[model samples]
Target: MPIEILMPALSPTMEEGTLAKWLVKEGDTVQSGDLLAEIETDKATMEFEAVDEGVIGKITVAEGTEGVKVNDVIAILLADGETADDIGGADAKPAPASSNAAPAEPSEATEPAAGYGRSGSAAQEDKPAAPAAGSKNGERIFASPLARRIAADKGLDLANITGSGPRGRIVKADVENVTAQPATAKAEAAAPAAKADAPKGSAMATGPSTDVILKTYEGRPFEEVKLDGMRKTVAARLTEAKQTVPHFYLRRDIQLDALMKFRSQLNTQLEARGVKLSVNDFIIKACALALQQVPEANAVWANDRTLRFEKSDVAVAVAIEGGLFTPVLKDAEMKSLSALSSEMKDLASRARDRKLAPHEYQGGSFAISNLGMFGIDNFDAIINPPHSAILAVGAGVKKPIVGKDGELSVGMVMSVTLSVDHRVIDGALGANLLAAIKDNLENPMTMLA
Candidate 1:
C-alpha cells in the first residue's frame, strides 16, 4: 500500500506551517530517521524526519508551500513490492490553506492513516482493544517507538494518552508521565465545565474590516506587508491575553548605585574569564530570587486552579525581526549570574535565528521584558497567559534621590512596572513580589549568597 505522509505538527500551538524545503524528491529511497523537510512553525524552523522506510513515490506538497495544516497529506511513500502504480487513485491532495478553510475531519476509513512510526498492523486487531472513546475519530495514534514500548510495558493505552509531541504524537515523556487511569475520561468530564465557565460574548472588538480600512486610505500609497506565522501568532496571543487576563499594574523605582559599583567590580575581576554581565542579567536573577522570596506570587492561573512552582522559571523577552521570543530560563534562582548570562545569550541568539526549540520558549510562570537598553523610560507589559506576572524594566538614569538622612543625592534609578494577573495574584502579593525584586537589585551582593 502507498502510505500517505501527512504534514507533522512541529509544536503544540502550530496549526499550520511553511514547507520551507524538501530534502528528498519523488523516486528517492528513504529510510527511517532520514531528514525529509524543513518546516517553519510559528516559533521556529525544524527538520521533519522520515519515520517509515520506503520509496518516495510522490511529493504532494511542494517546497516553499506555506500554511500546510497538520494531518494533511504532504507526500506518499511506497512500501516493499509496491510501486507508483499502487498510488493510482490514492493521490493525496495538499491541504487547503488555513486562512481559507478548516482542516478536513477524519473519515470513517477502516484502515488507519499511516502516521509517524506505525505501519497500521491488523495482527493486533484480534487483541483486546482499549476504549476508543477518546481516539480522534478512529484516526491512527502517532507515537515514537520508545513511547509505544513504554506504554506497552506500563499497560497504558496509547489512545488514552494525549501526546505532547509534534502533531500531538506520543513521545517517551508523554508515556512516562501518564497515569494508569485514562486521561480521556477526565478531559471529557472537564470539557463541558470549562466551556460553561468561559466568558460569554466577544472579549475584544474585531475592529474595522480590512476592506473598510483600505477604503479609508484609498488615496494613500501603501505596500501590503503580509503577516508571517510568528507575527500572526504574536498578535493573536497578545490580543487574547489583553482581552481575557484581568491585569493590574504595580510600579516601582529602584536605586542602582550599589549594584552598579558591585557589577563594575565583578566585571573587572571576571574580564580575564570573558564573563561580562549586563543589567538585564542582574534583573533576571533578581526577579528569580524575588519569586522565591515572595513564593505566594510565583503562581500561574490554570483556569480552575492555581499552579505554584517550587523553583522560578523566568522567561525573558528577546526582540527578533518582525516579532519577539520569550525563551525561558528554567530554574533561574539556582543558576549563578555568569551561568544565567551565558544561557540568556545563547537562548537570545538562537531565538533571533529562529533556531530555538518550542520547549525553550514555553512554560514559565513569570516573565521579564526589559527595554532598558533601548532607552525606554518605562512601559507596562502585557501578561503572557498562564504567567502570573511580567516585569517591564526601563533604563537606569541619574536622578536626585532623598537618602535616609533626608539629603538629596544623585543616584542611578531604574523604573519598572509589574503587570499582574489579578486572577492569580492579589494587589498585596504583587507589591511584595515587586518589593523583593527591588531589594534584591539594591542589595546585589546578597544574590550571590
Candidate 2:
C-alpha cells in the first residue's frame, strides 16, 4: 500500500515544523527513498524522505504551511493493486478504520521543530530490538516525558537504544530519531528484539507538569504572548525539568585578566584575518577540555543510571525571535579559536534569522549560556535535559586583587554558576569540573595548548 510521508522533526527542540516546500506534487510516483518534502524546524530546513513505497495518491498539507505535527499523515499512498479508493484501507501506523483522520501531519506546529542529535554508529550487539515496544504493543519513553510522547506519536520506540535524551531513551533528541531508523542504525534494525528486553520507564518518562509564566519585552509595562509551537514546547519541557529534577547550584569566580590580555594579543593578529574571538568562545573550549578531566559531570541521569560521554558537544544558548535556543558547537576541544568564533557567528546569525539547519542545534554533551554582553552581573541557569550540568556565565568586571608582594593589582573578574542535577552529578564532580574550567580560564593559555 502507499504510505504517508510526515512532517519530520528536524531538531530536538522542535515541537512542530513548517511545511516549507513539497519536492513532489500529488499523484507523482515516489520511491521509498525519494525526497518528498522539506520541513522548516526551529533550527533549519530539512528534507523528508518517502517512508514507504507508494504512488502519491493525494497531498494533504500544502507548502508554506506552519505547525504541522510529525506523525500525522501528510499524504495518501496507493498500493500496486489498489486504486485511489483503496488507499484509505491500507494499514496505517495507528489504524486505517478512521476515514476522518486528518490528511495533514499532526498539529503541534508551533514555529520550527528541531530533532535530537543522532549518530550513524552501529547499535550495540547486546542492545537491539527496542523499537517494537513503541509500536501498537508497547509505549515509548525517553530522557524526558515530552520526548517520550513525541517519539511515540512518531512511531519511535525507545527500546532500539539510540538515545538523545539524558539517558538516551530516544527523546526528541535527534531529528534522525524521528526518521525510520537504519537497518543497523542504533535503534532501527534491532528495535523489535530490543523491545522485549527493554525496561519500563527507562527514559524517566514520568515527571510533574511545569508551570508557565508570561513576560514582556524590556521597558514595557507588561506583555503576554500566546504560547504556540516552539514557545509552548520550551515552556512545557523546562517546567517538567525544573519541577521534577532536584537542581542545585554551585557558583565560582574566575580571574579573567590573563584571558583578556591573551585575547587582546590574539585579536591584533586575528583582526588581519577578519576574525574576532570573544571570551565566550574561550569559555566554550575550556569547558570542552574540562569535560575530559571530569566525565562524571558530563553525564545524563537516566533511570537510576548515569550515561557519560567521551567528547564534549557544547550547546551555546542563543536568543532568537520570541524564544531562545542553544545551537551546539560540536567537539569544541577539537576546533581552533578562529574556527570556533566563525562558526558561533554563523549559528547565532542564522538563529536570529530563523535559518539554522537541524544538525546545528541538536543535543550536546554540555551547554554554556552567557549574559555578560548585556552587562548582567550573574544568574543561574536551568538544566537542559539529559545533560547533567549547564554553565551560566556573567559579565567580566574590573576588580582589584592583592599581589604576591601584598601590593594592589588590577584583575578582571567573572562569575559562573553551574546548575547540577544531583541525581547524576555529585557535588564533588561538579566542583572538580568547575575548578578545571577555572584553572583553564585563569591560565587562559592551556585551552589553546
Candidate 3:
C-alpha cells in the first residue's frame, strides 16, 4: 500500500506554508515519533514529526516549496514488503474523504498544534487523517498513521526503509533528526518573487498589484520590497478593522508621579529577586483593575451581542521586525506587578524571536499599545476586531501645573487614547473605564486595595 503524504496544517488560520526542510530522504527507514521536516508558517519555523513507519518511495515536492496548500501531497510512502512496483495505482490527486471542509472555517475538535498554535503542545490533529494506509486489495500497512503521513510527505520508499517499531513497525523518531531552522538561501531569495505573485485577500484592500505598482515607477530609483506573511496579515486585518469596526476615541491624561514612585519602590524592594517593575507593568495592572471596576466597559463585541469577562485577559503590543505581536497576559488582574512584568518580558522576547504560539497571542477583551519607549507623546491605535477597545499609551512629559494649594508645581503627565468599538462600549461606559484607570494610576495605592 502506498500512502500519500500531505502538507499538515500548522495553525487554525494557516492555509499554506513553506516546506522549509526535509530531514529524511527517499529509501530512508522511518518509525513513529521521528522528526520528518521543518514547516515554516507565518509565525514560526516548526518541526514536523512522523506518526507512522514506512519507507519513503518518492519525493513529490522539493524543499523550500512556498505556499504549499494544506492537504496537498508532498510525497509518497510505500508499505513494508510492497515494492514500488505495487504502488502503481497510488494516486496523489485523490480528494480527501471529506471534501466539504472549508479551508477558512475551523473545525470544532481542536487538536494540539505542532509549531505555532500553542508553545509546547502537540501538532494539530485533523479528522479523517490517513490511518496506516491500506491497499485496495485489503493489505494493511502496520504503520502508525502519523508515521505513514511523514513517509508520504518525504517520499521515502517504505520497502527500503527499516521500521524499528513493535513487530518492525515504523515511527516518527526514526525519520526526523535535523534541527528546525530557516529555509535555504534559495527559498529566502525566492520570497520576494513569491509575494509578488501571491493573491490578495481583498482586491480593494490590497490595492494595486505589485506588477502595476512597479510599472508605474519603472526606471525610477526605487526598491520593490516583498510582503511577508505577517505583514500581509497585519495589513489585511487592520484594513478590515478600520472599514468594518465602528470606532470611537476616548482621551485622558493621568498624573504618573505616584505611579512612578510606587514602581521605583517596588523595583528596589524586589531587586534581590532580580525583578524590576516598569511603569508599563503598573499600567497593565491599572487597566486590569479598571476592567473589574467598570465591568460594563470590559465587554467585547461578538457580532450578536456583547460578551463580558470577569477576569482581564490583556493583550500588550510588542513590536517586532516586519510586524508585531499582541501577546496576552491572561488573568492580569490577579498577577502582582512583578509577576506581570516578568511574564511580559518573556512574552515580548519570544515575540521578537517569532516563537510565540497562536494561543499566546490570540484572545483578549482589551489591548494596550504603548509607544512611550519610542518617545511618542500621543497616538490613536486601530481597534483589533472582536475586542471592544485598545489603549494607546504615550510618554509621560513633565509639565508645570497648578497644585491643590493653587501654587505652581511640576508633574509627570502621561496621555492615553482609548479606541473603543462603538457597537460594544457607549461613550459613558468608555469614560468610566478611562476614569477608573486614571484613578488607579493617580493614587497608585488604590490598585493595591
Candidate 4:
C-alpha cells in the first residue's frame, strides 16, 4: 500500500510552519533516519527525519511554502511491492488521528501519518483510532476528534462551527465558541472572510492602521521591512504581556563597589582557566539565590492557580538579531557562578544561531533581563509568562554616597527594576525578593555561601 507523509509537529505548541527545504525529491529512495526536510517554526528551524524506508512517490508541498499545517499530506511514499499506480489509493489521504499521537519517526510503510518514532505496528497498537467517518448530506467534515466530542456535548452543529486551526480543520476552540450561540451566529463568528478584515492585536481597533502609518512615510524614502515570524511573535507576545498581565514595577539602586572588587579578584584567579566573569553573571547568581532565600515569591501564574517551583530555574534573556531568546538554566541555585557563566556563554551562542530546542528556551518561574551591557541605564521589562517576575539590570556608574560614619564616599551604583506580575506576587513579597537580591549582590561573598 502507498503511505502518506504528514507534516510533523516539531514542537508541542506549533500549529503551522514553513516547509523551508526539501532534502529529498520525488522518486528518491529514502531509508529510516534519512534527512527528509527542514521545517522553520516561529522559534527555530529544525531538521525532519524519515521514520520509514520507501521510495518517494510524490511531493505534494514544494519547498519554501509557508503556513503548512500539521498533519497535512506533504508527500507520498510507495511501499515495497507497490508501484507508482498504487500510490493513488484512498490510503494516501491522511486519516485524522488522536491529538496526542506519539512523535512521528522515520520508518517503513504502514500507519503512515503517526508521530516520529513509532513503527507501523506500534503506531496502530498505541494510537487511539480515528473517529468513525460520518457527516451530514454525505459531505465529510474535517474536525478534530476532541472538537467533535465538544460539539456533541454542547449540542452545536459541526457544520456551523469554524476552525481557526491549520488547513481550516475545526478544533476545540472553534466548537467551544459555538456552544452559546445559534447556528447562524456561530457561522457568522467562524466566517474566515470576517476575520481576514480585522488586523491582529487590537492594533487597528485601538490606533491607526499600518496603512495610515505608512501614509505618513510616503515619498520619504524608507525601506519597508517585512516582519519575520520571530518579530511578529515578539510583538504579539509583548503586547499580550503588557495588556493581560497586571505589572507592578519596583526600582532599587545597589552599591556595586564590593561586588566589583570581588569579581576582579575572582576573574584574576580564574584567568588561567579561561573563565572570565561578567557583572551579569553575578546578577544571575543573585537572582537565583534570592528565589531560594525568599521562596514565597518564587512562583508563576498558571492562569487558574499559582505554581511555586522547587528549583530556581532562571531564564536569562539573550538578544538575537530579529528577536530574543530566554534560555533557561535549570536548577540554577545549585550551580556555581563559574558553571552559570560557562553555560550562559554556550546558550547565548546557540541562541544567536537559532539552534536552541524548545525546552532550552522555555520554562522558568523567574527571568533576568540585563540591558546593562547594551548601555541601557535601567528599563522596566515585560513579565515573560509563566514567570511571575523579571529583574532588569542597568549599568554601574560611580556616584557619591553616605558612608557608615555619616561621611561622604564615592561608590559604584547600579540600578535594577523588578517587574512583577501582580496576580501572583504582591508588593510586599516582591519587595522582599528584590531586597534579598540586593543583599546578595552587595555583599558578593555571601552568594558563595
**TM-score of each predicted structure versus truth:** 0.79, 0.65, 0.73, 0.79
Q: Mind giving the per-residue lDDT tens digits that candidate 1 earns over 9-91?
A: 67766667999999999999999999999999988999999988999988889999998877666888889888877666444
Candidate 3 residues lying further than 4 Å off, grouped into runs, are 83-212
TM-score of 4: 0.79
Which residue window of length 10 is worst by lDDT in model 4? Answer: 105-114
Q: Clash number for every model?
A: 0, 35, 31, 16
Q: Which ten residues in a row are the worst by lDDT in model 1?
A: 124-133
The whole-model C-alpha lDDT of candidate 4 against the native structure comes to 0.79
Query: Lowest summed-lDDT stretch of 10 residues in model 3?
Result: 114-123
- CA RMSD, predictions in order: 8.8, 12.2, 13.9, 9.0
**Total backbone collisions, model 1:** 0
> What is the model-wide C-alpha lDDT for candidate 3?
0.74
Q: At residue 429, what lDDT does model 1 achieve?
A: 88
lDDT of 2 by residue, 1-449 (tens): 33444445455444467788989886778787898887876445677786566577777788887877654446666656656764442223333336876433322211111221111112111112122223322233333334444555555545544654343344344533467544455345345556545323322334432221222244557645555455655665677678778899999999998898999999998898898889998999899899987877777777667787877889999987767778988888889988989999999998887777767777786789899999998999998787778999999998898888999988889999999889987888889999999999998888777
